[model samples]
Target: MPNDSPELNHEVTAPRAGTAREWELFVSEDATESPRHVGSVTAPTREAALERAELHVGRDAATLWLCPADEVTRRTAETAALSNR
Candidate 1:
């Protein structure tokens, strides 16, 4: 059976109750390079988040940083400041 005439749809939902907080992990392999976002961890507390981050994303990393996703501020292309061209 070949069924190729269908639409694929996806929906995003908010975090659940017990595990409500999400922490983003930043991975740095060298001192000369700035850390970059590697992955995310969902946990009820920061300690668990840190542990999860270290186990998941920091296995081979030099350093890892975990911050609450809600506390972190980000600037997208739409909200970023424009420089003189």
Candidate 2:
């Protein structure tokens, strides 16, 4: 089956909060499957972020989502909940 997701094709622009920010990149080749996190990119703008991510991880993506790294929850192997358990 093809992706029935709503189009999110609008141009994406990052907020100019600082010089540059790290954006976490996720790509979906099969929409029925959750998008995979290919890698991260540091860019001054969302357009730049998309460009960088595309350059790095192209062909495998049908849809992409860019999220600020600062906003994403992070847990190192040492500090992860598994460590406490």
Candidate 3:
């Protein structure tokens, strides 16, 4: 369970004028049957995000996915639904 915090200060101007940002975390296989989420300290670099993920996975080889913030929720839902069946 690592804390994921990314410091991004970028603004977007358009029809939906707002701040454009992303939070990076790692999706790794859990030691137990249950799924666990671990986040790293806020980093503005992709390298930092990948580093965080590697830390969680430890020495094991893993498939890492750098999903967008919006996709996070969707993917979670899909996983949950499939697992529940």
The number of the candidate with the highest lDDT is 2
Residue 63, model 3: lDDT of: 48
Clashes of 1: 0
Please provide, for model 2 over 48-68, each residue's C-alpha lDDT reduced to its tens digit, 9 standing for 90 to 100: 998998898878777888898
In model 2, the runs with Cα more than 4 Å from the true position are 1-18, 75-85
TM-score of each: 0.72, 0.61, 0.35
Write candidate 3's Cα lDDT for 1-85 as tens digits: 6545454444332322134335445554634433435543334556765666677666653445554444465355545776676
Residue runs of model 1 more than 4 Å from their true location after superposition: 1-13, 16-18, 82-85
Q: What residue runs in model 3 are displaced by over 4 Å at the alpha carbon?
A: 1-41, 75-85
Residues 51-74, candidate 1: write the lDDT tens digits. Answer: 899889746788888999888887
User: Could you tell me the lDDT of residue 23 within candidate 3?
Assistant: 42
Pairs with backbone N, CA or C atoms under 3 Å apart (clashes), candidate 2? none
For all candidates in order, the CA lDDT equals 0.80, 0.81, 0.49
Q: How accurate is candidate 3 locally (lDDT)?
A: 0.49
- The predictions' CA RMSDs to the true structure, in order, are 5.7, 14.2, 9.6
Count the clashes in each prediction.
Answer: 0, 0, 5
Order candidates by lDDT, high to low. 2, 1, 3
